[model samples]
Target: MPKVVLVGERELRDLVPLDRAALDAVRGAFLALASGRVIMPPILSMAMPEVHGEVDVKTAFVPGLDGFAVKISPGFFDNPARGLPSVNGLMVVLSATTGLVEAVFLDNGWLTDVRTAAAGAVAADALARPDARIATVFGAGTQARLQMQALALVRDLDEIRVWARDSVKAAACAADIEAATGVRTRAVGEPRAAVSGADIVVTTTPSSAPILFAGWLAPGQHVTAMGSDADTKCELDPAILARADRLVVDSLAQSRRLGELRAGVAAGAIAADAAVDELGSVLAGTAPGRPGPDAVTVCDLTGTGAQDTAIAALARARADAAGAGLATDL
Candidate 1:
């Protein structure tokens, strides 16, 4: 018999702690990804006027791990019009031994948000400069807030600047983060201003055009672009990519199809052999990171299935440890 567990967003919030353990899981998954132990297909999605969404699948048979997960996330754009967020979804966890579902976590996308942010943190821990301090974030959405939080785990941030088209939203997010982290958080007027002097700059926008230009980056800076998870979306100037001393991605295949690399390739700014390294390779010590203090590094993260699998496993473990979920025999 298989047991299914349903955990709502609030319960899940209490169950899973996005701390070092969660990040270690995600990092292990990425190492597996580089070693070809994980199966991650290209994400697929469809959109209508009222509803728009994407379905991403990741299955990892991590040597000592028990379960794998398939997450179906959908976004109804009209929900925000009704005073709700545009995205909602759940995850299905399966036993690795029997391939039978062990649990279904109706986490309502909160777990996904945390895990993804932690992935950025993992990338930063491995690729971002050791002295990274000044930070810039380009979105005021939930993910943007989490990005700031996650980066703090890896970098001793000194100053933080936020930018959003909506001045009010950016101001509110800045104030909230400043109060929470005690970092000098302020809302800036331009994207350029947010990025200038920043040792690490993160872009979380949904823009088709470049939000970050090469002219804004200084030597030894690290840029993490988390916005281009779709074929039509890009958040970095191809010119900036050309200037990068090292270009790394979470997945080579995913980066080609949907990450900032896709945009750089289209613009004739990056060649097929242009990638300096993959984060997994760097983490696994197969490649070097931070070759020099003057090197410019860029990490393109098109969220991977490995991350989903890692987080799902963490969520299930937390649920079991806390005895927090309803197990329905099916």
Candidate 2:
């Protein structure tokens, strides 16, 4: 009987700290994805409009890797009213050679949260100006806080401006991040007020409509939107991508299907055949990023299977070294 492991969220959290190591792992996943050898299919998404919820299934197999991860993520938009988290799910890591389950990550969604944030860090490092400092974030959710911590790794961020529909939630989020990052975190009522003059802007809202407009952007600014991972979700105005000097996506296909790019393509603000570069291309040096100091760049992240597998592998290895998880025979 082969051995199977169950790694729960407690151990996983102790292993992955949303640090540089995790960022590099996600970076490797992007590079491997850009190699064109990975077998990543379109995300499988099902919407529960009646309940204001959604579930997405994503996975990828990178050649030469020992295993792959399949993630089942569910987002119940109305869960908060019931005093439950809006997002929660798990990942199943399987052996590449035998296609047998090696481990089950009962992370409940922490793995997804960190990997998504790590992707944001990778995009920011590759696209944001080298000297970027101030950052403005839209949304006061988990990703909103994690994204800021991740971006701090690549940029010398000393100030963080946050905007959310709920002013009180925004204020509390700002206070927490301010203490955690030692960065001046301020909660603003207006979205534009949060974005104006910012070097890096990150949108982490699950808003269905545009909360961020292109007119609020300035030259030399870079934006990474990680909120819109479903067809019904959009945080930035579609026209925002049209004005950017470059449009990069974690996966152009995924973006067109669900990410912020979908809104633009659907609205006719961007051509279907418009040249779009994947974030992996830039990370691999096959394409240019941050064209100039004043160039505007936008990266649409729709979460990838490659990332899920990579982070799962990293967390598993670390947990193994730390003697974590429950071992079982199957």
- lDDT against the true structure, each candidate: 0.83, 0.91
lDDT of each residue in 154-182, candidate 1, tens digit only: 88999999999999999998987787667
Clash count, predicted structure 2 = 0
Residue 162's C-alpha lDDT in candidate 1? 95
Best-fitting candidate, scored by lDDT? 2
TM-score of each predicted structure versus truth: 0.95, 0.97
**Candidate 1: C-alpha lDDT:** 0.83
Candidate 2 TM-score, C-alpha based:
0.97
Error of 1 at 144 (Å): 1.0
Which structure among the candidates has the greatest TM-score?
A: 2
